[model samples]
Target: MFLGVDVGTGGTRAILVDRDGRVVVSEACEHQPIHSAEIGWAEQDPDDWWHAAKTAIGGVMRWARENGKAVESVGLTGQMHGCVMLDADGKVLRPALIWCDQRTQPQCDWLNETIGYERMIELTCNPALPNFTLTKLLWVREHQPEIFAKIAHVLCPKDYVRYKLTGEYAIDMQEASGTLLLDVTYRRWSTEVAAAAGIPMSWLPSLFEGPEVCGRILPEASSVTGLAAGTPVVAGAGDQGAGAVGMGILEPGSVSATIGTSGVVFAATAAPTKDAHGRLHTFCHAAPGIWHVMGVTNGAGLSFRYFRDTFTPQLGYDDLTALAAKVPAGSDGMLWVPYLFGERTPHLDPDARAAFIGVTASHTLGHFVRAVLEGVAFSLKDTFTLFEELAIPVEKIRLGGGGARGPLWRQIQADVYNHSVELLEAEEGGAFGAALLAGTGVNAWPSVQAACAATIRAAAVIPPTSAAAMQAAYPRYRRIYPALKGVFQA
Candidate 1:
């Protein structure tokens, strides 16, 4: 058996997988809700992640022991771009500014001015964004200099948890790509950018490939998590990278559209693919010697969640989606802009706002709900449009996350993207992908691709049924954003 742990935004999940890639046991422990004392600011306690990881791992280990299975290796994965600072004694300096935090636009501007936008993109294969770790660190340096002064080590969320588990400071190339501090073309820390940003290279963790063993489980972690001390722990990718591995999106032309809290359209590439405008994020893939380009929609599933929580509290997600299913393809010409947390792909504007446009008295509640689903899909389709411009192939599109689970949303994605979408037979997501990396670390599989090929299989495909309607509506959807841009900014 191999173990995988994911330090997710809301919780920590641990899963045990057999040599064949079957998940034998899985457990999760939720953390406290993210604290957002002010708008556009999201923070979480790093210690909370450690506690949840211990609890989740303990549960899975208990199951493994009862089943007479021994975990051979462990892998770690989680949300990317979160800035977790530690002092020389390895204590958390402050609450981590999470990936969704949007209070660093001023810092982003400063970086862009200091390094030039194109040059910054040339170095990191991505532009400075509020969601990136470097900007969050810069925000701290400016606002909370005391904490910044004490920072002796820097790690992403999962790497911080790994530090607790193994007493080692390490990060994977794939996760480091989102830091805006990596020379992604070379897969190393960028001294130029670090210097310009007033950051020290020594503060960064040691970089490793996703499937390489970077540390061993320490005795202290073993005591709390019920694992044997000295078990090898592999460097795993971030949520997007590992989730792609779990979905078998490894080669060029293979793509995935996942709608979790955020939406991502990912395509694997043999080389690092750059977008001159910096719309798509080019990052290292979990598989060695490969790269991926992805576009993010910050408020994909969140759009539907907000609608459900705000207006239809009595209705569950399935109930809301069922209502959406009753509506026709284009929501009777209504459209939604899913910029609740500001836009990412195609537009790097953090000040962008959400809106419902073209609403009429004839539109019902169902139309509103269906429009939200289609709007999120439309936002994701922007990435596919960028993919075409960059000449990235998209021969197959696999669907994952909350959007893929619902029949309505899956078909909606197919229609909006104007392509057939596939579903996996057993999509356990990042933790499962981490387990595959763990297996690769121990030679249970020759490589990440082999582990995926042996274990992952597609279950179904949803073809585009309302392509013409969506194709027509998409142009109008495109127009809405541009027309409302000034209004949103105001």
Candidate 2:
């Protein structure tokens, strides 16, 4: 059995997967979120991540032992862009700045206007978003320069978890790709970018590819997690990289659609290619040497969660989806732009707001729910067009996440994307992907490909069916964003 550990903002999860890729045992531990009382602030305790990870893993191991699954290796993937600063004694200096925290907008804008957009994009393959690690560091530098000055090294969320498991200082390329300090093309830290960001060279850890084994779990960690002490622990990537692996989108030209707390449209590329407008992000894939372009929508599944809370009283996802299925394509001219938490792809505005347009007396609650689903699908298509422009030929796509849970949403995605979307037989997302990386590390399989072949399986595929009217309505949906771009800024 391979153990995959995923440390997310709200919780920590561990899954024990068998040779056939089925989850034999799974466990999770939820933690509280911490934040600054001031405006636009969010933070999580790095120690919370470590505590939750240990508990989740220990729980999974206890269950796996009862289930007769033998532990082989372990892998970890975590929420991206968290700034975990360690004091000289390896203690967390402050609470981790989490992935979705938007307090660094001032730092982000300053970097963009001062350092210049083209230079940063060319260096990092992305804009200086407030969510990125560099921006978070800048926030610390300005707000708590004393703590910043005392930093020994910085690790992303997953890297901090890996330190607990292996007692090693390491990180993966894909995680570093989000930091804005890595020269993405060169696959190393950039001195120019670091100096510009006011970060020192000594603050970063040595980076590795996702599939490589960084070190072995120490006996102390073994005592806590109930795993073998010398078990190989792989240097896992951030959540998105693990999601790509989970969906079997590691091959070139393969595309993945993932929606959990947020949404992502990831297209694998053989060579590194940056989006010309710096609207999309380019990153190294967990698969050795390959790269991927990803466009993130900050609130897809979570938006549905909000809508369900507002409209339906205790209706589950299936009930809501069934209600949506009653409504026809395009929601009968009722268009909903789901930018409630602000848009991410194509338009990089955190200030972007959502609205329902073309509503009439004919539109019902079912129609509204259906419109939300279709709206999310249409938003994903915006990112898909970027992959097309780069000629990153995508045929069929693998779908995962809470959005991928319903057959209705899958069908909507196929129709809107005008392509087939297949589901992974294994349900766990990043956790399972991390286990596959661990399997590769332990030589449990000859390579990452072999592990995937031995374990990963497909569940279902939704193919694009009839919808000439919906296809025609796509242009109108595309225009809504442009018409509202100015309003979004306001």
Candidate 3:
């Protein structure tokens, strides 16, 4: 059996899979609410992640043992772009700056200016954003010099958990790509960028390819989580890369559109594909010897959740989606721009805020809900526009995360993209992908591709329900950002 664990934004999840890739048992433990002491800033306790991971792992292991399964290997995956700092003795220095934190714009500007914007992209294949790890580190250095002086190690969220489990400081190529401190083309840390950013290279972890053994569960971790001591832990990809692996997006021309709190449109590439404008991120793929380009929408399901929390806290997510389904397409000309947490992809503006345009007295709560949903779909289509410009082939589109769960969202995505989207038979997401990586490591399958091919199958395919309405609505949606750009800055 193979075990996979994902340290996510809200929780940690563990899954145990049998030799054939069948899921035997899965468990999740919710994290404490993320601390947001200031607007545009987000933080989480690394110790909390470790605790949640232990809970989930123990739960899954108990169930697996009851089912007569022994977990032979483990893989790890988690949210990307978090900055976790540690002291010389491996004690966490402070709360981690998670992916959604937006307090690093000044640092991003400094990095671009110091390294030269185009030159930075040339070195990292990505433009430094406020959410990237390096920018978060810079924010800490500038704002808390006392704490910065004590830093001895740095890790992304998952890698920090890996250290707790295996007593090793290590990271994978796919996760490293988001740090803005990696030479993605060569799959190693970039000394030039590190020197320019004034970050010490010695603080970085050892790099590994996904599916390679980076460490083994130590006696201490095994005691806490109930796994066998010395169980091999494979170097797993970040959540995005591992999720793509689970959805069979290993080869070029295959793509995925996933909507969690954020949305991402990912396409595998045979080689490093650069966007000279740095509008999209080109990162190393979990599958060795390949790369991927992805565009991000900072707020997708987040917009919907924000509305629910503010206006209809009593209603559940499914209830809101059902209400949204009752509304007509385009929400009767009402449009939503889901920039609630700033925007990524086409516009890397950290100050950009969300808006609801063309709301009328006649509009109902359902209309607002539908508008938010449509707005997210439209934002994701912006990536497709870039894909067309880059000539990145999109032979198949797979939907994952919140977007794949609902019939309404599936149809909405298909209409907006003007292409059919496939749903996987099992949508266990990043944890499942991590398990596949573990299976590949243990030779359960010869490669990640073979593991996915053997286990994953399309559950359904949804085609565009109405192409004309989406065609009409998208142009108006496209106009909202430009019109509000000035207002956002002010």
Q: How well does candidate 3 match the true structure, expressed as C-alpha RMSD?
A: 0.9
Q: Give TM-scores for every candidate, taking all chains together and pairing residue i with residue i.
A: 0.98, 0.94, 0.99
Predicted candidate 2 versus true structure: per-residue lDDT over 1-490, tens digit per residue = 8899999866899998877788888899987755756534668998888899989999998987787768888888988988999987789999888777777878989898878888888888898887789999888989998998899889999899888788888999999999988888889998898987778888888888888988898999999999888988888889999878877787776788887777899988878888768889899888787888999877677678778887786898778788889988888899888887667788887667788889999788888899888888888888988778877788778888877877888888888888878887775789988989888887778877777778777888778884575687789988888798777453
Give the alpha carbon lDDT tens digit for every residue of 1-490 in model 1.
Answer: 9998989887999999887778888999999988999977899999999999999999999988898889899999998899999999999999999999999999999998999999999999999999999999999999999999999999999999999999999999999999999999999999999999999998999999999999999999999999999999999999999999999999999999999889999999999999989999999999899999999999988899889889999999888788889999999999999998888999998888899999999898899999999999999999999999988999999999898899999999999999999999988888999999999999999999899999998899899999999999999999977787767454
Off by over 4 Å in 2: 33-40, 310-313, 486-490
List residue ranges in candidate 1 displaced over 4 A: none
lDDT for position 219 in model 3: 100
What is the lDDT for 459 in model 2? Answer: 85
The models' CA-based lDDT, in order, is 0.94, 0.84, 0.92
| lDDT-based ranking | 1, 3, 2
Q: Which ten residues in a row have the lowest lDDT in candidate 2?
A: 33-42
- Provide the lDDT at 189 for model 2: 92
Task: Record all residue pairs in model 1 with backbone atoms less than 3 Å apart, i.e. clashing.
Answer: none
TM-score (C-alpha) between model 2 and the true structure: 0.94
